[model samples]
Each structure stands twice: as structure tokens, then as C-alpha cells.
Target: MGIPLLENRTSPAGARPAERARRRRYALLAAGTAAMLFAVGGRWDVPLAAWLFPVLLLRFTRTTGPWAGTLWIWAAHIAAAAFWVYESALGSGPVVLAGAAALSAVQAVPFLLDRLLSARLGRWTAPLVFPAAVAATEFLITLLSPFGTAYGSLAVTQHGDLPLLQVTSVTGCYGIGFLIAWSAAAVNGFWQEPSRPSARPAAACAAVLAAVALAGGARLALLPHDGRTVRIAGVSPARTVAAAGRAALARIPGGRQGIAAAPPAAVDPATTAAQDDLLAATRREATAGARIVVWPENAVPAQAAREPAVIAAARAEARRSRVYLDIGIAVYDTTGPAFGRDETVLLGPDGAVLWTYQKAHPIPGSETYKPGDGRVPVVATPYGRIANVICYDADFPAMMRVRADIMLVPSHDWREYGRPHTDKAGLRAVEGGYALVRQDADGVSAAFDGRGRVLATADSFGADRQTLVADVPVRGATTPYDRIGDLFAWLCLATVPLLAALATARSRRR
Candidate 1:
């Protein structure tokens, strides 16, 4: 016998208004529960997001219209992204949740678009719109406001898939994002018996990832740290940044004791000796043919090229010691901050000033500065082709900028964040295909490889730090980031608007 037919209509033509209201209420409640989970993303969690997908997929597939279920899902997708944004900005709070809810409202455009696209393209194409548009919007928004990670991005969900992540080495993170999403799309499309699911595309993608991982792993496994022991030094001498003029005067070496404005030429014996000692040791190592000698971000407060005295002294030391020096010196454009920003410079052998990358991005409330529009000059040396940046600038994926083999991230981490800074910086290394050199004053000054593994770690900052010189392999291949440059994101961007237009036309047509 058939079950109770609540969905059955008493009237032959249609349900009565009161019955319709009752059914509508039931639908609304179901929508609300789905909406809440989508907002909170409980489905992706231990018992939630993962299970949610299949059920929702079925709901979508079985619905009368191709786009029937997506509006609700997109609403959830956006809600989660906004929550992440709030979490990043104001920290976690009820207000953040509120912001997330409001932000979730931004889903209307995509939802309308998804429905139209689904109706037109039919089955599964609509689903792809969600990830593609989401990625696009995330990329665009990041261009406008540098707030929060792309938390709603599905890329992070595949974080554990080492081989899958290998695509990052060539195309950056977005390739993996597209792959995982497309994999989900394929799985969703074929799992229902009418269509045969070919695992080949997914398998091929996975295989390529695995091969890259194996190759990278093999290289790292065989590589060694700076094999010989050397007494490397890191200094964090306090210098009040109140007055640039006074600071320059204070550079008169021992003249710092005088507490008087002194000539740039005036020299203090002890302070001079200390700086000279730094130079002397650097020179000694270089003379001893040391591979690399590193210093903290802004090792010397002044820009080298612009400052004759600083340059003269560094060259003297470089020439005297013949050591390849990598010190983070603030490149001051005295006439005016070039692009109104100070930059970090890497002085190579013979004081040739091999690599000088102006920071491509700046942090808000940034005591830090921006680089010039001229060039992001990457230098070549036996150590590696290098892309060097200072402190906070490292957070940006370096999208829209030139690529590099090794990134010299000269940092000065503060007390608020310590070792985690090093770990987070490793993200750049992972995505960029290099072991980054993170040398900071008050934190975990360490080295990490392209795989986000810390090849070497440092002691707490400010403890007469020792230099960590490692013999990293010089690589020339493009990373996934280099090739794609936010591929998935751009795809999303294109899909969203196109979907919207189609939905608009369809609405008018109907």
C-alpha cells in the first residue's frame, strides 16, 4: 500500500491557499536549516560539510529544474566566506557572524545566474558556476581590500593532498582548486548510474601531482644544510626611529653617546667597531668562501644605493671578505620615498646589488613601505635566481608580479606574532617552489622549502641569533602559481557575471 500522501492535494486542480501556506512553511523551515549549515559550514566538518554535499547534490539533481537547489547552496557558500572575513578582521564574534549573514546576502547575483545557466546549459554546468564565480569574486575582492584569506576557497580543503598540491608548484594554488572542484563535478555527474564515470582525468591530474611531489621530495631528501659550521651572527640593536636626521647623526658610531646631532662623517669608535665587527665577520666568512651570509630585515636602517657611506662601507666589506652578503637594508629614496615607500635590497658579490625587489604590496597601518613601479628585478647567482621581499609584503601571493626561484623574505616579526610568522611565511615558499629565508629580529627566523616544510629553524629572536646558512638547490621551473595566476578565481569571475546576464534574460523571457 502507498504511504500517507501529505504532498497530495485535496483539490484536483491545485492545493487550497491554506494548504499551500502549510507546505510553504515546511519548505521554508527546511531551507532555513540548510541555510544555517551553509552559513556555518558545519557540513565540511567532522559530521557536517562532507555529508551535506552528497545530500544537497541529490536534492539539486532530483529537483524539477536544473537550478532548483543552487541558490540556497550559494547563499551558504557566501555566508561562510564572509564569516571568514569577519574572523580575520574583527576576530571571532557574534558581530562577525552577523556580518557573515549579511555578506551571505551577496549570493543573490550568483544564485540568479546559476539558475539561468543551469536552465540553459542543463545538468552539472550550473554546479561548476559556484566554484568558478566564488573564486573570481574572491580574487577581485582581494584586489580591492587586502583583508582575510580566501577562507571560502575550496583549495584549502585539499590541503592534505600532497600530490594534488603539487600542481601548485607549476600553476599555483588555483590549479588545484579547479582540479578538486572539477573532480567533485565529475564525481557528481557520473556517480548516478546513467553516465559512466571515467576516473582517468581525475587520476591523471592526481598522477601529475604525485610525480611532482616525488621529484620535489627526492631533491629535498638528498639536499643538506650549510654543511660546515660557522659562527653566524644576528643583531637587534635598538635605535629610536623618532627622527631620521637624529638617527643619521646617531650613525656617527660612538657619537651615539654624545646625544648630539653629529655630522654624517663623524665616527664613534665603539659603535663603528660593532658595525665593523659585523662587516669584519661577514668579510671573514666571504674570504673563507662562505656560500651565504644573511642579516635581518633592514639590517642597516638606510638604503644602500642612495646612501653613499652605507654603500661604500658594504662594498668595502664585500670586497674585503668576498662573501655573498644577503642583508635586508631599508632602501631610502631621500628625495622622496620612491612611490613614497622604502624598499629592501640584496647586495650581491662585488657589491653589484644583484637583486632589488620593491615590495609589491603594503600592509594597512603599515610602518612598512612599498616598492617602485619600475621593476621587480630578480637576480641570478650560484645560490639561486632570487626574489627578495621585506617583512609584511610577503603575505601577498606575489600575484601580478614577476616570478622567482628562491624568495629571500627579510622579516622583522614583532612580539605579537613570533614563530607562527615563520610558519605562515612558509606558505609563500610552498606556493613559490623555493625554500624561503625568513630572517627576523623578534621571531622565528627560519628556512622553509617549496613544500612548506621548515628546512631549518631559528632560536627565539633577539638572543644573539646565529645565522642559518643552508645550501639550497637553485631551481628554474615555474610554480603552479607562476603559470595560472589565479586561474580558478578568474574562471569564477567570468562565470558569475555571465550567469547573471543569462538569468536576467531568462527572467525577462519567462
Candidate 2:
């Protein structure tokens, strides 16, 4: 007879290995959550560079222990999302978790789905499979909700890829996002240990590199620099104080007068008119025989049809100066399908309406302002065909689809840290192979050519008034992005069927 030995056990007071294991699991989950939250809120400017998303997820997901990787990775996403929820839930004004929290949940879906595949699928295909799933998730669901925003999307990593960004003008930003996610996923595959099963991962990494080289070719083919004369306008009809009060008043659905409330701050009687006059001077500087005159958002508050005096002056200026007015003014759509208090307008050189782009994106402080459902149509004139995107519309990748040789962004940013917005917008112009004209209020008003190079810039931030004039080139070549819109996103989406095939093949072999 042989004696049997019992397994070792810890006493109630002792630190057990299981306890430490549990703590590790909890820590991974926490990391995943933190990553998601940070990416979603735009709180961190250099989010990916500071904390590479793929490496973080891979560390948590590629663990050897059973069920450990999934928990840790999921934790990483959830913890990150919670940061966004907690900040908003505790902030000033009313507490709300509707958009921010829901968006966080939406982001977490990919991690949960990825883990399910990662468990059964061989590590060989991690690069191809993982990026595909992520890209698809971003694309298919990007337009899922009525207000789904890719504002903090994973593709933002390509912020440094000026040439690659041009692809968005043709296909849209979602396509660019696909490649970026794939690159990160492929990178993680290379770092995962246990080399015998890492072949497919290497292949995935190859795919990313190949795609980047292809993008480089397209960028090289497009002429990146051109010097074209572009006249821009910067109009400010009201002073800071009057504009503030008027902005507050502009919010309520109105008939120009009889708002039952007072402005946010009293208009400073000393300098309101002086500020408007200063804007007039800047407008003159911008329109002196420039190819196209630019305008600021909400430069004139009066309804377009009702402003005979304002229209007469603008019309006379365009005809006499022989300069086209792309001036931003408020227009009414009393009987239109939708009702908005104000819209951005474009007046022609012949003293007629060339095109009018209603503000598509509405932000806080604008009263009863509804979004303009339609995209801005590209207008062809003697100067060139131009696509007019107003204010918040620049953030959307879909807006890049409208056909135009050049882009005109009319914006007003009195708020500080407006340079990032300008930089991002300017990048979009470069990515799409078009000259970008921006008329800004206290911002980086700029012009960029088709190859994503800056032509001219009014580098003065928070200035009293400024205008930038330079030659705006009209480029015609469509980028690969235009031809292959969101192929990366589509590849990501196809992961669902791919995993099924892998499982079936495994069963058959068995």
C-alpha cells in the first residue's frame, strides 16, 4: 500500500497564490476600461502616442492562463469608459450619461467580441483578424446612432500622415481608420511571444505595411504644392460684448426682436460699434482683387431676406470691386422642411446667391438651432469649383465626399485652443488633394493646396481682426481613398464570417 499526500493549503491569515491571481485579473480589467474612456473623451491630446492602445490591449489579451486575457482586456475598456461617465456625472449643470456613457458602451462591444474570437482562433491570424474586427465595428456602427460621432475614433493615430489623410476626401475618414487599427493590431502580433504560432500575425503586419506603401504611392502621384491666388474675407459685425449678448439672443427662435429675456452679459456700450468697424476694415483687406473672398460664421445676424441695407452694401461691394463674396450671413428658411433660427450664406460676384450652406453642426450656446440635413453642394464659378463646409461640419468625415476642387471652411472660434480645430481641418484639405480656405475668428485662418501643403496663413491668434490672401490652386486628381472607401472597415466587419470558418476548419480536422 502507498501513502497519498494532500495538496498544500494556505491558512486563513496567509497570502495565497489564488488571491494574487485574482488581483491581477482585476487589474487588467481596470486597464482596459481606462483605455476606452481616455480615447473617447478627447481629454488627452496625444492619446495613442502616450498610451499605445494596441499594446495595452495585447498585454491584457495575450496572457497564457485560461479566461485571464478576456477579463483583463475587457477591464481595460470598461475602466477607460468609466472615467468619461464619472467626469460628466459629477460635473456642473445637470447630470447626464446619455451620449457619453452610451458611446462608451458602444466602444466596449469590440473588445468583448474580439475576446470571443481570440479565445478560439489561432494567434497566427491575430493581425488580420483583430484589426478587421475593429475596423468593421467602427465603420458599420459609425452611423448606427442618429448622433454617432467618430470624434475620438481609433484612426486618429494617422494625425501625422498628411498624405494618407488625403484618402478621406475620396473614400472618407472611416477608410483611413481601418488601416490605422490594422497597423496597431499587426504590431501587437509581432510582440506576442510563442513564436511558432506567430506566422499569421507577421502576415497581418505585412498587410498594414503594404497598405501604407500603397497610400504613399497615391500621395506621391498627386502634386502636393501649388501657388494660387485666393482672396479671403474676415467679417465681424458686432463687438465681443455685443456679439456675446447677440449670440445668446440669437438662440431663441425669433422674429429679430421681442426676445423675452436679456443677453448673457450687457453689451459694452464703449466699443461694440468700434469692433464691427474693425471687421469692416479686415473685410476690405481680404477682398482687394483676391480670386475668392472669404467670410466668418455669423458675421451678420439679420435675416437675409429682411436685410435690404446690408445686402445692398455687400452687392455693391462685389460688383464695384469685381470680387466674389463668400460672406457668411444669417438666412431664413421660414417654409423649409426644417426650421432653424440662422444659416451661413454665400453671396456671388454678380450680387446674387451663389450658394448657401446652412450650418450642419450645432454646438452649445446656439438657441433652438437645428442641423441642416443636407450637405453643402459644390459650386462652380470663374475662380473654381468650391465645397463650402461650415463650422462644426468640418469634424465629420462624410462631409468630405461632396465633389469640389477646393474647400472653404467658415468658422468663428472666440474660444481658446482653437488651433487644433484649424490644424485638423487644414489636414483634411491636404489629405483630399484640394486647396483649403479658412476664415476664422481669433484662429489660424489658412489656405492649403491639394497636396496638403499650407499656402498662406494668418498666424495671429486672438487678434482684433485678420485676413489671409494667397493663390488657391484647383487640383483634379482623385485619391485612392475616393476609389476604395472604407475597404479597411469592410475587412474588419468580415471577421464575423472568418471566425466561423476557422472554427469549422478546426472541427473538420479533428
Candidate 3:
């Protein structure tokens, strides 16, 4: 009796310490996962971190109880979202906070699904669940959400890895994300079992990833680049000139609210100076052997009554220089809707209006313009087939699928969103097999070839004259993604249901 009592007391005591140790280890893992999430996306991102964080997260979730694991993962996502809002130009208002919280909750669904389903199925099939869930979630968000592919895209982190990024031509952005998530799940399987047999899944996944990289490399090396090239120039008004225009506008009575009451004469002087600067820059670029000249978004600001005159002047400039000119203008209406118009007008070398495209997607909460019809316009030019979209419009992959050689993106960006935004846009070049030229005001302007090679770049903040000139390819390649659309993403989405059903059937059998 005495021996039995002693054994019971000691066993309970020992178990308490073990339980505490387990909880401590889980807490550490949770912390590490949160840190990785913070460092994986948004402004401060490491490509390797994107691949590693999911592994840690999968391991942590699998080891803990379902409810507890979900809570911790959600907490980690919240922390990451908070960090992103802090680091990005997005403000920290209640709406933004609520949005972040909702997004965090939605993001945690993949981890929850992985934790619940990965263990219930066969080891081989288990790894498929998490990646499919992740890819499906991302695809749904991009297809359904107004934000498009602006957030939570794992592909954006791997922008610097051109060879690895080539898979996007067939899979869109979702394929890279699926590969990363699958790698994470496959790696976690080895960590959980740690046997020679357990290593097979991870080894196979490694082989698959290697094959993808090799194929992408082969595509890049073998692609023909002997097509004709066109010299294109992008220009933005000098900071002083843009600032002077803004200052002049600020001096008007009632400021923005008084635009309706203010006469057209009151606004002309402020806008005229900036317009003159851009036209002069366009002329200089054309003289320097550029066949195409583009201005940044909203480069010319005019009252509604004065817009025709502005277009006429741009037309004259294009004819005089014998160059194709693309002009961005913001037309303020005094009598109509409170919102203004954001549009781009392209002029041929013969001074004919080629196309007038309004911005299809305006930055939410920033630009008040009514959205344009989502149709992308393509024009056949002597240089090549050309198409254009405004800045935020380029973020949507589906919207960018135009059969054109060169995609001109006239953009306006803040200092914080400059380079990363441009890098994200470059992925469109890879997916659509078109050269991209982005002219940005108050940001970084760059040109990229279809293979995601940077041709030229200029930073508005760093340069006295914010201009870029590049020899862009005059022919476009046809990609599987451009032809098949989001079939890969849809397949990933379809696999999720099939996987879930299989897991359910297996659990019932057991």
C-alpha cells in the first residue's frame, strides 16, 4: 500500500512537468510562425521565408489540438496583418482593422483544413489537402474579391526567382503558391514520422520542384528573342512642377469642394505649367530616337471644358514629333457627378486619336472616379499591337490577358508602394507573354520584357528627371495560361473537395 501511494504521487508530478514543457515548446513554435508570417509578405518580405513559414505553421497546427491550434494560427495571422498595415501605406483605421481581422480569419482556414484532414488520410494523399486548400482559397479570393490578386499571393514573394516563376505561365500565380504549400506539407510529414519510408513523400516533392525549375530554365534559355524591338520612352512631370500645380489648386476657395463653383480660368494656370513640362519632355524623348512616348497617370489635369484643348495640344505634339504619344489626364467636372475622370488617350504619329481608355479599376477609398467598363482595348500600331491600363488595373491577372505585344501601364504610386508594386506588375508580363512599360508619377517607373527581364528603370524620388527609355520587344508570345485561363487554379480548387471526401471516407472506414 505504501509503495503504491508513492508511485501515484511521483507519476502525477512527472506528468505535470512534461505537460508544461509541451506547452512551452508549442508557444515557441507559435511565436516563430508569427515572426515568419510577418516577414513573408507585404513590404518586408523574404522569398525563402515564404517557403519556410508554412512548414513551421503546419507542424505547429498538427501537433496541437484542433481548437487550440486554430486559435494560435488565427492569432499569428492577426499579428501578421497588423504588421502589414503598419508597414504599408494602408492606414490603420477601424475599417482597415476589421478587414485585416476578416482576412486573417479566412487565411487560417487552410491551416485548419490541413490540421483536420492531413492526418485522417493516407500519408501520400494527406499532403495534397493542404496545398489544394491553400490554392483554392487564394483563387477564390482573387476571383471574388474586389481586391483581386493584390494581397496574400505567395507568388509575389518569389518575384526575383525568374526560373521558378515561369510555372506561372501555365498555372497563373496559384501554382507557385500550391507548390510552396505542398512542399510545406510534404516536409512536415517527414518531421512527424522521421523514418526512411517517411522520407519518400518529401523526396518526391523535391524532385517535382526540381523538374519545375529545370523546365522553366529550359523555356527561358530556348525562347527566341530575335523579334523586332521598339524604343519606348516613359515620362513624369518634375516634382516641383507637380507640387506647384497642387499648391495652386489648394489656394482655390473651398478647395476640392469648391471645384464646381470655381471657373475654368481659375484652374488653367495651375495645370498649364505641368502640362507644358510633360509635352516638352515628350518632344525631347522623341527627338532622342524614341518611337513611343508615354506619360504617367494623371500627368495632365484639366477642367472639363478645357479637356478638348488639352487633347488637341497632345495630338499636335505627337504629329510634330512623328511619335506615338500616350497621354494621361484627369478631367474635373464642375456640373456633373462629384467624382472626376481618370483616363488615357493614345495618339498616332498622324495625330489621330487611337484609343481613349478610362481607368477600369480605381484605388478604393482614394480615387472617386466611377469605374470604366472592364474591356481592355487593343490597337494595331506600326511599332506593334499595343494595350494600356491604369496602375491598380494591372494587379488583376485576368484583366491583363490581352493579345498585344506591349502593355503600357500608366501609374501613380506613393513612395511606400513604388518598387514592390512595379515588381508585382512585372509578373503580368510573364503570364501574358507581353512586354510591360509602367510610367509612374511619384514612384518607380520600369520596363520589363516578356521573360521578366528588367529593361530600364527610373525612380521619381531619386532622379531629377523621372524618365525611362527601353528597347521593348515588338512581338508577344502565346502562353498556356493566356489560352487556358485559370484552369490550373480551378483544378486545385476541385482537388480540395475530392480530398476532403476521400479523407471522410477513410475516417469512416477506420
Candidate 4:
């Protein structure tokens, strides 16, 4: 009887206007959300847009049909989120497009699932389902592609909001993500209904967010007493090498004539110049009263383990300068086919080897070296408990979840992705509650405090070599994120299936 009445009530022709209007609304909302995401991304990083995009997307999803929501979300994410990777993979146009499409499709899946589940569970549950499903998806994506970790996630959009960003230290970005998504969903539900049913969820979400903000404020206020300042210097070698090459070519017989007169010096000669430049920068920084001097990834020309002179020269420089020196070099395996591992060695002020760490998480395609098998080490230093990781290791949270006051990262970034890459690495410092000193060979050499505030930055692409010096605070406040490590993400993962099942049963009963 009910089925026959429902069938008689609705006709395709009668519903066309409403359906078309809904579709138009969905399209507008999708476009607006896409624009917001693009604007508030790594380039601009506006926090308000982070909240607005999710709210609009949630409204669109709630109102639109499942298939339409999925298609719209895929299109929007492809244009906004996935396209960011194109800069890193510009060489293969077709491959880049295909990857973007694939990533968009994957990103769309969670939103689609959330819409379907919310339709069954009712709008009240939307707030809970959206964050859980999306977080689970993010965690799964990270498992498949390590780069998928909340490196450039929407949480980063709030980088300028220190109190808001403090949530990362407790929940590893997912906590903030959950709050953002939940607030959006709750607001959408209230705005759509405008009744008592929606009021409860909206108020609940507001209360929870207020609590989070208060806790963040309290954490900031009650932070551990400011520790001693460590004067650190980060040197970029690319500009230095370029400067030296120009000087060398100028001394040649027909230097002003043409490119033909310049020897094939872009390779070995540039490497030699970079090594010399790094050593010079170390000496200069040491003399300038820097307690710690850091070099960019692969600062040495060849394998340091193979050549005793290379290590001897660095040791001599450390001794002469009387500063703690950290240098990144390739360490070759003695037993095999000279397969090298990327490594960073820390030299104490007395020229003694303090700590050595191999790059644990190497870039997949570019790095042809074995990953480090050792544990993440936090060595004690006069400044504080200092830890070191080389280049790609900074991307993985697990590789950096050590108890350290300061983290020294020797990074090498591609020209296009320098700033965002450096910023993402700084997010690690935020999560682990430590100061970061990141020296990049061909990128932005930056220093960030525990609050993820950029203390100093230097451009490695400029004509003149620049070294960044900053007095960075050490020994940050203790964070639950460092202690438990992705617990909030794991809880989200565990809740998704249960929520789906409950929603299905509730819908069946209805």
C-alpha cells in the first residue's frame, strides 16, 4: 500500500524542475568549494577558506543525489587538490593527468560514502560520519602512498592560526580535521533544516570546538618555560655553486665570448664548488657565534665513508670553528656494489662524532639507496636533546616521532616544490613539539619553532648565496601526539565501519 502510494505521488516530469534546480545548486556549490580550496591551499593558506569549503561541500552533498555529489566532488577535487602534484611531475604530461584523475577519483570516494551513510542515518549523524570516513580514507591513502599523510591536508590551511594549529600536537592533524569537518556538517544541517532537530547537533559541535580552542589556549599558556636559545645556521649550496661557477668562468681566457668557452663544468666542477661553499659557510657561521651549523642534503661531493680525507676535512673544520657541525653525505656499503645510503653525521664542538643517522625514508623513484634500519635517535646535546633526519625522512611522521628538543633536517627539494615541501616538513616539528632547522640544497632553507612559526628563511635559487641564522627556542611542551602517535586517526578508522553499519540498520528500520 505504502509503495503504491509513493509510486503514484512522484512522476519524473513533475519532479524535473526541482531536480534541475537542485543540480544547479549542487554545481554552484561545487565550483565555489573548489575555488575556496584552491585559494586557501599551500600557496595562499587562508584559514577561513578551510572552514568555508567544507561547509559548502557538506551542504551540496546533503542536498544532491549520491551519483551527482560523487561526480561534482571528483571534478572539484581534480581541479583543486590533485593538480598541485602536477608541478612535481611536469615531465610526463599524460601520466600527470592520469594520476590527477586517479587521485580525484580516490578522494571522491569518501565523500560519496559519507553522503550515502548520512542519507540513511539522518543529518544529525552527518557531523560524525564525515570526519570519520574521510580520516579513514586519508589513513588508507597514506598506507598506499606515504606522501598521502596530512602533509598538504586542509589542516595546513590553518598554519597562520597558531592556537588552532596547536591541535596537531595532540591529534596529528586529524583532530583539527575532524573538528573542521564536524563543524561544517553541523552548520549545514542546521542551516538546511532551521528547526529544533538541527539545533542540538549544531550546538553540540560548537561546544566541542570551543572546548578544543580553550584547551589549545591553555596549552599555549601553560607551555614549558622557554628553554635556552640555540643559535643555528642553515646553508644552501645551489646559489653558492652558481656564484662560484660565474667567478670561475669569468677567469677563463674567452669567458665573455660564449657558452662554448665555458668547460663542461656544470657537473663535477659545480659539485666541488658546492662542497667548498658549504665548508666556507660552516666556517663563517661558526665564527659568527652559531652554536650549531647545518649543511643541506648531499653537501659532500662523493661518498664520505669511502674517502677518509672528506671526513677528516669536516672534522678539522668542526674543530677549528669550535661549533657543532651537521653534514649530509652519502655513505657507501663496503661489502657490496658500492650502493650508498644517504646519511647525516653530527660532530660535537670537540670534533668528536656525536650521532649519525641514515635517511630512513628515501624518495621512492629518485633515491636508489637502502633505507636506514636503525631507530630514530635523539642524542643529548648542550643545547638540548637534538635529533636529525635527512631529506625525505621528514615527510613520514613515524620517522620523526622522537623525543627531541630540536630536529635538524638536511633536505633537498625540487625547485618548484621548495616552499610547500619545507612547510610540510615544519608540520612535523609542530606535531612532535620540537624546533626545526631545515637546510635545503636547492630550496628554501628554513627554521621553524615548535608552534610551526617560521623563524627564518633563505632562498637557494637567488644569485647570491644566503645563510639563515636564528636563535631558535628549544625543549618544547610535551604533546600527546608524540606520545600516542596517530591515535585519533586510528579511532576514526575504527569508528567508520561501526557508523556505517548502524546507519544501515537505522535506515532498514525506517
Best by lDDT: 3
Local accuracy of candidate 3 as per-residue lDDT tens digits, 1-510:
897677567753466676766766587566557656645446687788888888888888887888788888888888887777676677877767776777777778899988888888897999998898888888887777666666778898888899998999899989999999999999999998999988999999999999999999998899966769999999998888998888878888774546635787778986788789999999999999999999999898888778899999999999999999999998787544544788999999999999999998886555668788978889998777999999999989999988889999999988877887888899999999999999999888999999888999999999667999999999989899999999999998899889889989999999
Give the TM-score (vs. native) of candidate 4.
Answer: 0.84
Per-residue lDDT over 1-510 for candidate 4, one digit per residue giving the tens place of the 0 to 100 score:
797687578775666687768766767676556655553235545567777777777677767788987898888877765546544433445544565566667767767877888767765676688878766666665556645453336665666677777888988866776787788778877887899978899999999888877877777677743767989998766564656654654555532222232344423354466667788888988888898999887776443333355666778889999888888874433333225657788888888988777777766435656778747767788788988888777766766788888999988776777776787778787898899989887778889888787889987776477588989986765678899988888999889888889888997898
Error of model 3, residue 332, in angstroms: 1.3
Question: What's each prediction's TM-score?
Answer: 0.60, 0.76, 0.94, 0.84
> Which regions of candidate 3 fall more than 4 Å away from where they truly are?
1-17, 20-31, 37-41, 253-257, 335-338
Score residue 378 of candidate 1 by CA lDDT.
72
Superposed Cα deviation of residue 387, candidate 1 (Å) = 3.1
Clashing pairs in 4: none
Task: Report the error of model 2 at residue 271, Å.
Answer: 14
Better of 1 and 4 by lDDT: 4
Candidate 1 is scored at a TM of 0.60
Residue 420 in candidate 3, Cα distance off native in Å = 0.5
Candidates sorted by lDDT, descending order?
3, 4, 2, 1
TM-score of 2: 0.76
How badly does each model clash, as a count of residue pairs? 21, 30, 0, 0
**In the order shown, what is each candidate's alpha-carbon RMSD?**
9.5, 6.0, 3.5, 6.8
Tens-place lDDT digits, model 2, residues 201-270: 6675666557765775676575554444455544444345435646555555543332322241322221
